[model samples]
Target chain A: MADQLTDDQLADLFAGLRADTVAAVLPPGADAARHTVRRRRQARAAVTGGLAVAAVAGVVGVAVAGTPAAPPAEPTGPLPTADRSALRDLAESVLPPDARSAAAWSFSLGDETSNTAGELPAGSYRMVVACAGDGGTDVLVRWTPRGEDNLFDPERAVVVATGETACAAAPSPATLRFVTPRDGEVMVSVEAVDGAAGRAGFAYRIVPAR
Target chain B: MALTTDLHPPPETTRAVPDFDELYAAHYADLTVQLFAYFGDRQEAQDVVQEAFCRALARWSSVSRYDDPVAWVRRVAWNLAVSRWRRARTALGFLRRQRVAEPQVDGPSPERVALVRALATLPGVQRRAMVLHYLADLTVAEIAQREGVAEGTVKSWLHRGRAALAVQLRPTGTEVSRG
Candidate 1:
């Protein structure tokens, strides 16, 4: 009998089903509603943009991986070995005087295993650093500052073109600090060859002073 | 530099707009009910519908005059629900650990609840077609136009949706439950 019901009968059945009227919960005001809408729309836009950037990066990563390449050149200098403790120390030293350690970890170069230091609240500048030997090879530090709400910044120049370097000498060790001035929650990542990449980590808070 | 600039949300619109209060009064309850059926969660339904209305209010100057302003709200609300459904389910699982109270449920009959649950099990396309067809009173052609699908596809969805619903809603005994 249920299957035999005509379309009209089915429609009528649903239409006739009585439902309790939901109490009207009008928005605070039109202005407030407008702000809410604007914020949500902007958030959605950010997510969409972030996904697009991720896609581009993914494609670039694929293309780079596909091409045959020479092995990364060894740093022809009396540089310190890219060990964990040294990398951790170098990354930690760059923190602003007020910057408390939010989270920290070490990674071996070419491990391709990334670590998220931890989360930062909304509307914060996230400064990340990749510390390694002065191998002078390119290090890619990428991060997505994503909120608990999943909003993310995708367009940030996570890795400047391979040749565009941001390295600083740290005794025998060298560092690449990718200072991502951003808002909302974010995750950071660093990648390099087995010998060049060291540790990538970050610290952040809302209204982080410099 | 290009990436940093792109992160900034576009400038807000500044122009004459419609009377959002009046529009909200006209559409909020109905949109909420439609979405409640769509999501099988009244709180999520209301939240997404309210969000859609707020968005409509934001672009009232442009959206108010569309041939069907309500459709715009429904489309946005549905999209929001789909996106939220994935993330919210995961987040809610964690929130449940925190012992957050679930939203208050509107009273519904046992049969209706069963039916809605069955409806929820349908694929997204079929569910959307059925909701627009049965709840929203949208014609198959209208759904086709709105969803940017062929009319035949809409018809197929409605047919498949009905077939699945019939099995789910089929009677089990001599006692027939009235719709």
Candidate 2:
């Protein structure tokens, strides 16, 4: 009987699906979207401009150069031991002062691991994943609700947010901000891009947005 | 600096870019619906669409100058959805080995679920072709241009995809069980 269904019938079915789905969605408003884009722009500008260097110097009491105009060259061999405290300081320098730490961890390239940050009420939070090496390495970071922590289980994990950042001489970091839909524990997972599992150390911290 | 130039193009060379607010207002719901039909997850679809808009806004100076800015936004949203889908598929495979069943959430109508399930069974390219053709009202040439394939390839995909959907949705077949 289905063989009798024509193209018009299939189109009608799709049209019905479209109407039902569109009616159920409530857009987060253009104003809210504009605000998000503005915030992201400011963050990227801060990172790439002199503001990041100034902030780091102010917080750490050391002069730091602006991020180089040219891309940092890739490391050929093993990287130096990651300075955890220094990386943390660099990460915190770019975030709001009131941001409270929820979880922090360190890992190497080619390793996929996750950290659970207990339960958090519906609110905004920031994730800072930093990589410290001579140069060229990137890490993928993902956030998912806790019980769904099977980093391998994509269907159920329902990733709330994700980002990627390259490693650099300084603790080059990729920062992502997201809001929890409801009160729930969340897990943050980090995986390095495929390559030699060089000791290019990485660190990530999750904190509540002020 | 190049960044400065990108942010503030010369007045003489600048074109009349569409208002961001108006663009968002006009296309947000439609784009979200298209993504929802593609992925079968309302929240995820909305998120990806919103993220795509955010990206467009960030690069508005460049994006707004495009011949069809909405196409840029749609492409970005589709790219994001595809990346997430790939990650999910990888995770689903691992979980399948562990015998962990994903929790099902109730929302869509029975008819919608049946169609979505049938669509899900098709290969990714074919399913995408079906949705883009039937739901988005895109012609074969348009889909071909967007997908960077020949129009004949798109026609074949649509033909095969429709035939498969018919078999899956047959009334007497066990494939689509009605509620």
Highest lDDT scorer: 2
lDDT of 2 by residue, B75-148 (tens): 77986786666666665657543432344454567677678778878887899889888877789998897766
Report the lDDT tens digits of candidate 1 across residue range A85-105. Answer: 555456355443434534444
Off by over 4 Å in 1: A1-9, A16-18, A21-210, B1-18, B93-106, B172-179
Best by DockQ: 2
- Ten contiguous residues with the weakest lDDT in model 1 chain B: B1-10
Q: lDDT (CA) for every model shown? A: 0.48, 0.59
- DockQ of every predicted complex: 0.09, 0.14
Candidate 1 has an interface RMSD (Å) of: 13.7
Candidate 1 docking quality: incorrect, acceptable, medium or high: incorrect
Model 2 RMSD vs true structure: 15.1
Q: TM-score per candidate, in order?
A: 0.47, 0.53
Over the stretch B1-179, how does candidate 1's per-residue lDDT look in tens digits? 11111111223245444466877767776677677667776667778887777756644444554556678778768766765665456657576334324433545655656666777899978987888887787899998987668999999999998877776666554344469
